[model samples]
Target: MAEQADHADRADRAGHADRAGHADHPAYPVGLRLHGRRVVVVGGGQVAQRRLPQLIATGAVITLISPSATPSVEAMADAGEIRWEHRRYQDGDLADTWYALIASSDTTANDAASAEAERTRTWCVRADDAEAATAWTPATGRSENVTVAVLTTTSQGRDPRHSAAIRDAIVEGLRDGTLAAPHHRTRAPGVALVGGGPGDPDLITVRGRRLLAEADVVIADRLGPRDLLDELPPHVEVIDAAKIPYGRFMAQEAINQALIEHAKAGKSVVRLKGGDPFVFGRGMEEAQALAAEGIPCTVVPGISSTISVPGAAGIPVTHRGVAHEFTVVSGHVAPEDPRSLVDWEAVARMRGTLVLLMAVDKIGAIAAALIAHGKDPATPVALVQEGTTAAQRRVDATLADVGERAVAEDVRPPAVIVIGDVVAVGPHSAPTTGQDRPGDQQ
Candidate 1:
């Protein structure tokens, strides 16, 4: 029995060793390249159109074959940007091509092209069927001296949509100075968790904006606002974490891991996020992760949308006599879960105001919950969309009607909802009749 026990222990140790070995494997292979190559694209629709510009920028000699072409492609062909066959792909279309793209709408043509390219020992990209290709286009990106390629291969190729998204993120990161080359003069790496401010780029703190200008690598989410990115230098490095409205995202764990990995590689990393990183931006989590890794990091706060958004819409949470205080809550959290740790009853009864972030989607339910918890149904509320920007708009109503009004007005995300009597003090409020009564009339 003792011999058997020893054997089991040995097996367990071997298993753990094998697992560790697997875990040490890299997430992806590196150093893929496709510069100044001859390539062919088999279609001319929107997808083909999308790939053309990127291919041209990579200095690839692209030959497009299609029965019909989009106006953009035709214009490019006219301008000598690319060669267009203006005919359906022939059997020998893949011949003499270093790389071929099978983007034809017909599946049979795509298959034939793939087979032909394989026979010629040339690389083929099956635009739609990535798995069948000899090589797949990853989300190819270049920021300063940093090049990024994201690929998902399940013993196969990749998904085109996912690849495109990854590429776009990289481009954004680059343009925003989020992806920059490290200072070769210094090997020490530092990190900055910068708040991107509210919707307006002007609201970004001076320090935060300066850091953005100096960023060697920037990793930001969709909410970081486009105007801020527009301010980045041309050679900056930028990366997108794939956080889009109502879309799947790169897990926060993965994002944190990426940030640390890049910083440890001796690159100045900037984790740019919307609004103040401490105001429910999950900046704390990222900071903790960096601390545990012993990486130097600093937090630069921005104007939190929690207060600025409401204020931008001309609604004050606290007034001299109207409201003595205010409460801020995350609409992104569950109202029913106790661990959400929100004191709904206290907030409802407090002689103050309430401001909600990321609660637009659950407005109706939240309003109902608040009323049920003893908050007045008649409390004035204002939904401010794209606050502090040229696109700013507000929908005002009572707590009981604000959600419905928001929907009716088509108020979208990136909005803040303010609930309190202060909303009634805005310029749009009913004018006092006393002042206009007699001699004031023109």
Candidate 2:
């Protein structure tokens, strides 16, 4: 009887603590399915601009009532992404609203909107006041298909910066796969052509990474993410695509046959190529071959090396008021080659950024062709080798001396050459090596 009394006293103490924790701060967290639901957003300022994207992504039927909106919000309205009413908020605006957000600058307008939502028993969030708001906004994050939201409340009020920081930390863990693995597993009897994004392992898309994790056999290109291949389990087979030589028309045919043969045997084949597979990776041809054999296949787009490599070296392909246009060109063959179809002379006359891939061998003749066609000899140039990787290096030179300098520096293939005034505007353009100008000899 004494032991039973002691147990009852302990249970009573536990119940009191639980009640104390919930006192005046009980928040019921629930994931609302807002798709195809009616949502009314008031104001067109910065706060509304920030919240509108999440609503659009959720496929919410948004009725925006505002006198004026930010440039981004205006663009969305013009594009017909949302229904924008160019007027002030009315009391009847919340009549059918399932959710409401008041972010207007005027406190009077915000108060009026909130009162209407209360009358309708709709959840309302006020950007200007946390204490007065019936609903609090949470910091939102996403990784793969997973969503994470966090809200931090302090003794004084709510702290958004703290919440966002926590959200960012959680997102980083999700991205690196330390916190969770991929949800969808790629099954066999098909092939996936994935763009690995330049030479960086982390740049690949979330879907590409998930599919690759389930690969039974990965046919990898020389430019593909080699680091990712190393991460594969021991059971996975790694095939070097470069080892398979193509002398003539049979080369592509051989690749097609390889994919078809492996997939037919019930293996999940991943054709990992550098940058975007469709750009210059010949991905469509492989897909065609698979389709001819009636094989299941899908293509995942990747960041193209043509643009990404230049950006990695701090060279913007297009700069406002500097270069309004950019063009990607292949220089695997010399300009003088009869088989080359690009009009080199016409390209030289255009004032835009020129990105050259596989051009290290023919750069001298190409530069000469451009210069001969009235391109400036002193046009700034940058060669980004092995871009977006540990072995990356940038060599800055002028159109007049790029070929000679590249040879002198021993710059090799798998490099992107950027030409035009945009090159001079990059961080590497400043002569750190004290050669002619900044970033030269880097």
Candidate 3:
């Protein structure tokens, strides 16, 4: 008992000395070269959860020593990204570890791991006590290829929250282009399918914009943000995707071939489409085609117009106490047409928002069919022309008068026809023209 007491006394003193030494010597800011090195993490709680991802990204062979860990940490272990020991930290857990993170809430266990790390000549980080840690983790932000790390040691001592705020601000600036990235294009050679989001240039995602800037060849859709094309450099080859054979399958194949051929010719190609590629845009076909040729493809998803267009015009597809469901259907063909597969009778029975895309031409026939199928003639409708763009216009009508109203108002194609009570809830209330004018010819 006396010998064990003396050893415990020695361990306590050693821990106190280690803490004092850490406090006396401020941490020198440096990024670790942890690539392909063994890193031992002695804890599986919240603190370890935050640190594990950074270590994993560095290509570190992580060995997590803990009886139990957070669900995310457990998931990482399950995914084979990190090796979890699933046991308490033993004396020599850090034997082959090049770096150690002692994040256990149990101070004694943290001390033991830190001591083991120190003895093995490994850098150790302590979450419970930064003063006891030989190394400190910096708040980090990455923008494109640049990683910005902010360490608050003495100058901004013990204020990780402030450091993180600064890091976030830097990241925000990077995303918004307030901080300039090198104009020199640096994306890897491959085909990137970017969703341009409706017809607005600003709605394009940050990654999409960055990739667009790097594109050597851009295959642009007709409905894609046209303003973005004007911004591209003179040297960039821009192909009008709509002009590529009008047959759906043929056009898709041609677009895929263009992407593959461009990439094969050592050009970075971007297939920019309006709305999400998978949402009626047939983006996966392009991706699958690229995959067959072993050509890498990157997809940047965009906001779909089915939701965005209505929402922009102050029409929520799903509203509380009004609509719980919304159905978006292509209106290219008439319900009476043999090629049309839509169940007009069933659609008429549904008491939900009906968003009709590409249906302006056959909308009168569609409305007539809906009413014939037991739909109310007074169901409100809002025809949004070129929604979410400069050419945006809304014409109010009802199922009974929408067809005639459309003819009277000279409503054109490329308009979204919103039907249901949700259309009544639209912010813009343009009174429908009751009288036919001389030049109001459809």
How much does each candidate deviate from the true structure in C-alpha RMSD?
21.7, 9.0, 9.7
- 143-187: candidate 3 lDDT, tens digit per residue: 777889988765325799999999998876676444546656654
Model 1 vs. true fold: TM: 0.55
Distance (Å) between predicted and true CA of 373, model 2?
Answer: 5.3
Q: Tell me the lDDT of model 1 at 55.
A: 79
| Stretches of candidate 2 exceeding 4 Å from the true structure | 1-26, 79-92, 108-112, 131-133, 150-166, 169-178, 182-189, 243-254, 265-268, 318-324, 336-338, 348-351, 367-381, 396-404, 419-442
Candidate 3 TM-score, true structure as reference: 0.67
Q: What local distance difference test score does each model get?
A: 0.79, 0.84, 0.84
In order of TM-score, best first, we have 2, 3, 1
Worst 10 residues of 2 by lDDT: 433-442
Worst 10 residues of 3 by lDDT: 243-252
What would the TM-scores of all predictions be?
0.55, 0.75, 0.67
lDDT of 2 by residue, 174-227 (tens): 665445454366554799999989988989987677677777889888888889
Off by over 4 Å in 1: 1-187, 427-442
Better of 2 and 3 by TM-score: 2
Error of 2 at 403 (Å): 4.3
lDDT of 1 at 70: 91
